[model samples]
Target: MEPMRRTVWGMLAALFLATAVTVTGCSVTTEDPSYIPPAPLPPLEQLEKAPLADPKNFSSGGDVLSFITADRTISCSLTSARGEHVNLPYEQNGYSDAANNKLPIVPVAHCGLVTYQPPQPGDVKDDCAGTHLGYLGGVALLAPDTARYGECRSGVTPMEAAYGPGGTKAGPLTQLTVLADGQNLERNGLRCSAYNGGVACGNVSAGVGFFISPERYELVPAPAISSASPQAEGPKTP
Candidate 1:
């Protein structure tokens, strides 16, 4: 009877140990090893608000208002489609289609660089077959609203030749006003801002814009807006 009693106590001890191990295993948890965090947002999206550009930094002419960066690296001009001069160059340049007999003069914001490197052959899509690819002329934000990075010129223009070391001197940007850093100018539904890094310009309502610097260029698309908020309207000429 004494041996049987000892055997029963040993069996009880074994049951208790098994239960403790099961409970401990249930409490242990392991994190997912394959999980990855999302990338951060671009710096431009983080800007709280954009202030109106200083009036002194821009000059308003017949149908265009032009401004230059403080460093004189970039120059931009805003043209209104409704302005009288819009038809002059389009007609003289013979952009008018013979069938329509009229060319659409779009409200546009265009920028030119005093100096920049030409993108590698495959870097950007080149529409210009015979013409020299122009990079220093920079980018343009059209009111019909698309951002274009390079231009095709008939020949190597002054700005195109001005790329290599100690290149040709840039001429006066048509005596344009200076748009200093941290300031922005808006006209005919287009806006351009200057920063320490580079210049960003685009059609505000459409959310289409571009960023240009001596080193690189990027086309920025409009961010998604919540349905609860009002939709931004398209460009309207004043």
Candidate 2:
């Protein structure tokens, strides 16, 4: 009886030990790995707001005169591509109050520009552009406004010359705009010879240049851009 009792006790002890081992060795299976959540991102703040984002829509600054005379140009602050903060976006407009060459502020005949209309396709020519604006003055040419004998010669003009921010190699723009008014300043269209002759009529003037937006604009630093140039990765991989 004593031996049987010892055997039974031993069997119970062995069973308890096995159960404990099994529980300790067991692992839980889960679709997700043991997780530690990432820290949250910072909130975004408003950067910039410009009412004149569109030029054609023309809430403001549609033309040089209107832009220059305007009492104030509004803009907003913003973050840049490279993590810089800007106070005013309109600064991108590059509106300068600097005195221009003092040409009569006659309503810009055509706010748009004129390029030497290249000669015909088959025409022999070394230059893709017509005679330079400089030479146009000396050449006798019918006036677009008057059809009268050559009065104003055109080609490369003063606007093409350098001043202020210097100038682009391209010729200076003339009349940088076209106005509805002709010989006179009026809301109505002009009565230039072209208008009467049933031909296309546009005004011409000189000293036009492109304007940068005054709105807050961001630019990537040159170094980062240079580093990421096309050759940055070497030859293309198949």
Q: What is the TM-score of each candidate against the true structure?
A: 0.56, 0.17
Best by TM-score: 1
Give the whole-model CA lDDT for all candidates, comma-separated. 0.60, 0.23
Write candidate 2's Cα lDDT for 88-189 as tens digits: 122222122233323222221121111122222332222325553322211111111221111123433222231112545232122122212111111112
Query: What is the Cα-based lDDT of residue 16 in candidate 2?
Result: 92
Superpose all Cα atoms of candidate 2 onto the true structure and report the RMSD in Å to 1 decimal. Answer: 26.5
Looking at candidate 1, the ten consecutive residues that score lowest on lDDT are 83-92
TM-score attained by model 1: 0.56
What clash pairs does model 1 have?
none
